[model samples]
Target chain A: MNPTLGMYRPRNTPMHQAPAWFKAVLLVVIAAVFVLFTDPITSVGLMAACVLLLISTGPPLKATAQGLLGIVIIAALSGGFHVWRGEIDRAIDLAADLVGLVALALAVTSSTPMEHMLDLVSRILRPLRRVIPPETMGLMFAITVRAVPEVARMMSESRSAAKARGLDRSFRAVLIPTTTRTVGFALDLGQALHARGIAEEGDNPAPYRRARRVKH
Target chain B: MIEFLDAEFTAPDSGARILEPTTLTLDERRISIIGANGSGKSTLARMINGLATPTSGSVRVDGMDTVKQGAKVRRVVGFLFTEPSSQLIMPTAIEDITLSLRRSIKDRTEREAAAMQILGDIGLADKADVSVNALSGGQRQMLALAGVLAITPRIIVADEPTTLLDLRWRAHVGALLRSLPLQVIEITHDLEAAARAQRTIVVDHGAVVFDGDPAEAVEYYRALMLDRAVGEPAT
Candidate 1:
């Protein structure tokens, strides 16, 4: 199980089977509730509910904790700021609300498969098909999701290369290679897209083909 | 059939020849191309699918001009890159396959079912939901092939598809590629794999230096490499 944030985890649960639109609406409603009710007790209770929901999905506890580390750092910083201004109760409320929202988001993403999200994006963009192709946009979103780990890997490689030359502390050394590699990767991806014949008008636009050819 | 009618490529910026004037007809079931680094072998393979257009002459697949009918030619020809990560655009194996079938299969359920069937055929059924990043290099290459096969391409043009795989995986993928019914034009540094092809082509310094029997072509390529290693200047 990778500890990357917002990555889908395979599971068998109601949340996993739920449709993308439904989960999105539920997320918005829950988020609204959290914002509307600012009391520390209510926020903490909501956060607990979110955590339980996440646990029910059966993801590894350690991975989940690691995935939430970024949010934790931000929450701590905000809380520290409030505490320095002598608003202890406000800090607790704010931190709890932030944690609850992120946990709920993680629960939704971990349960929902990327296909569902892509389908939902296609449906949402269908209305704007005249200006932008829905299929192309959906594919773009998928590629963006795929590029996350690749960019991270490239960044790690750049850091190592810099360290080898004793330039690890220099931002320019890391930034230059990472940026160049990312651009090259993008060029490769563009060629792949072209080779795949995506967003091309050559293929027939038939809604359904009666024949499904076997794999070559 | 793929035809290169005096096809040639030149660097747009430097105006240097990448592939010299070449006239060739490719109809073999398996064709292997071998060359040194920057020898324009990749440029030749890319032209088959219109990824790299010739500056002067024309390349055609089944009589369809690559420049004018590139998209249609791409449907007939599927390309595989050396690095599978660049080609696998979707987050998961099944999703990537489904994306490949998007134009062919319209119904979502049917597309997904077809994707699953392809995954199963490729021995990746259990890993369908697994993230692409988590898969081993060989598995990712297999997934990329699955995506290419989902489109049912008549011709598969692979540019060093197995160069990144380990020895065992290279053999596995090589055997799998050989088993395909479609015409396969592969660019390889692996002489043994090239020797297994029906025909072999040796490219050097923007020209087809040799094209004939597989074993003979391999010998020619080896000799060419030796000459270069001994500090021979370009002809």
Candidate 2:
């Protein structure tokens, strides 16, 4: 079966037992640190740390490699560009940073339940209710994350559809339907939300000033 | 009760009337709408909860105006669409139900508990944390229905809810839908299901052609289709 996006994989690791919010915040801090670092030796250290962290989560290493395949390819191409520019050390550093960042992200995602993560986010954003509804934003964030897989599926399907009729050479025919279907999906999604009466945020901007204190 | 007071609907794109002016008072616990594709039955059903607002008139649910009190009206009416995928927006089943309960239950712990109870009611407690994309079609549809029912809406408006399921799943889904305690307004192609409703409505060419007992209404619709079949020249 295809791996679920940002879904919890029931594991009894220490990371799995860690608070979802803590892991979420930690991932962001880790990403920022990786972005700031520049040296290959330091980045290699970071990559080793991330690998140890990922190993603690106890998922199969082969599965991790498969999940990180895209990251590997991109990192290779990016690192190769640095080497082509006569910066071999820089190439290794860049690849290490990329790989470390993605590994940490995957580790965090696999450890925490997505809903727990989103709920914590919603609570943290509650004070900004006057500017925007925190709950709605949380829902949007989850939807956006889930949409990545949906969009990916659509892309593969579009390629196969184009190849079926030997219209693979025609970008117009393939791109048009892919783009059109994405828009259609949005429209259908909007209608579905409306039907479910979950369009509460967009219709009412910010009336949080008048909101009464309710028990959480 | 859901009431349509001379409601009319015009297609925004075509600028043509899809639902002619119609007046109805729906108080039945179970009412089914039967019609051919694009025959305005969905347009009528949507008006109840303000999914499709009346172009010229008004729709009221238990005296609450659907347009003026759109949000409030929506709180009372839950909708189930033909395609379940659109309804399962969250990655996992529990999360989707939790989303439904966000308005009602503010506490995250309480909301999760409530969602779990709803899932258990729908026989999906074991699959709570499982991604919805991984579920079978019948399970997905059941989860979608569970999401709607989680909020405890007063009425459920299902537009061809079983159209996408295979025979067994279709029967299973239809039975599950019929067994709901709340008032249900279903628009469907299944005459057998339609036959079980307290009342049935028939729409044709964007208008209500028949409304009465389920047996008579289904008979009228079948006869109308048969007549059209014989009257029209073979292609």
Candidate 3:
């Protein structure tokens, strides 16, 4: 039920202070380079660097472990798949690269606060203002980050309620209520948006529209 | 006056008749609807905001037809549910309220300012930027109220808004609702809240069995409950 996007453990580390966009761009670059090249030394070096970065970020070891659970499973599956195909070295390298990239990104999120991350994203997106309003993108990122936990909480509660009612195993029992609750939540959010005047006026394009325009 | 003309509702799941045919007019500003679970009180409140349309009957708010003008009616009738968490859509407190003003203000700065003003009014201005998940129960309810109030609705419909809170928070929220300037229609089991309202309606078996002054309505409901308990004993 932990719906949070990542375990953003708050810390006063240097990595947290670094701009989020910098980390984002770095992650993309590393991922692309790792995938394109087959140098085992370079992959090992990157993996070592990511481990060091994660240790310095100072998140609870337990939280870090839980957050990386998915990445670990994916890495294992890919590595096993490669070994099954008799490409052991290539599999190990691919797994190392993928894990290194994911760990680096997780370190950034774990160290940085959502507000700062949003600010960094907005700053990076500022040039595309003519196409996409930076503020809207910033707000959207903040909301997405915040909603992760909220949605997870909702799903957990729904599951519990379904279990208590002895209908947890029934798809109709679970799906119908969960979907209804989700839609209800969305509508309530929409109403909240309307009340707070977040809706775009007839003349104004949506914030995403601006972002899209900049990309074009 | 709020009026329901031949109100009847069919359950969405089984298509069973839920609300029996009925008609009533409510003129009092503060009214409470009390009923047991599945007694149809919640459905009755939802009908006011057009959240639930009657299968055959018609609901009117100050003479505006709920079925014919559902959207317009919703603008004037702000609905609050017992679970504030479900009602809250936005991640942060101020952002949630700001979202409600999306149509009223074009400028982001102005919208934020207005949202802050509302938070201040609700005594939550300091928590404007805070994530809503971090809020206490009372604070979350206040934020939910702020979200509803940001729209400047004239009527507020709350379905057991305080049922989840502790005794202190329950009283706090009840008092706050009673003090608001908007017309309040509260569906609750809290007898203390019923005492504060100008009028009360007791619903049983999907029908309004009692309607009048709060004192009389409470007495009637208490008697009905007692009779049911005694008569159904050992069954």
Give per-model TM-scores. Answer: 0.90, 0.92, 0.71
Worst 10 residues of 2 chain A by lDDT: A207-216
- Candidate 1 residue lDDT tens string, A1-216: 232556787777988888889998889998998889878788889989988887787776887888677677888899899999999878888888898898998788778877778778778877776555666677777778788778988888899999999997999999999999999999999999889887666331333121211121
Best by DockQ: 1
Q: Over 4 Å off in model 2, which ranges?
A: A1-5, A60-63, A168-170, A199-216, B231-235
Docking class of 2: acceptable
Better structure of 1 and 3 per TM-score = 1
Best model per TM-score: 2
Error of 3 at A57 (Å): 9.8
The models' CA-based lDDT, in order, is 0.87, 0.83, 0.76
| lDDT per residue as tens, model 3, A2-89 | 3333445546788777767777777788788788877767887888798789878876667567767778789989989999999988
Per-residue lDDT of model 1, residues B1-235, tens digit only: 9999999899989999999999999999999999999999999999999999989899999999998888789999999999999898888888889989888888888999999999998899999888888899999999998888888999999999999999988988898899999999999999999999999999999999999999999999998899877887767
Clash pairs of candidate 1? none
Alpha carbon lDDT at A124, candidate 1: 89
Clashes of 1: 0
List residue ranges in candidate 1 displaced over 4 A: A1-4, A31-45, A86-94, A202-216, B232-235
Pairs that clash in candidate 2: none
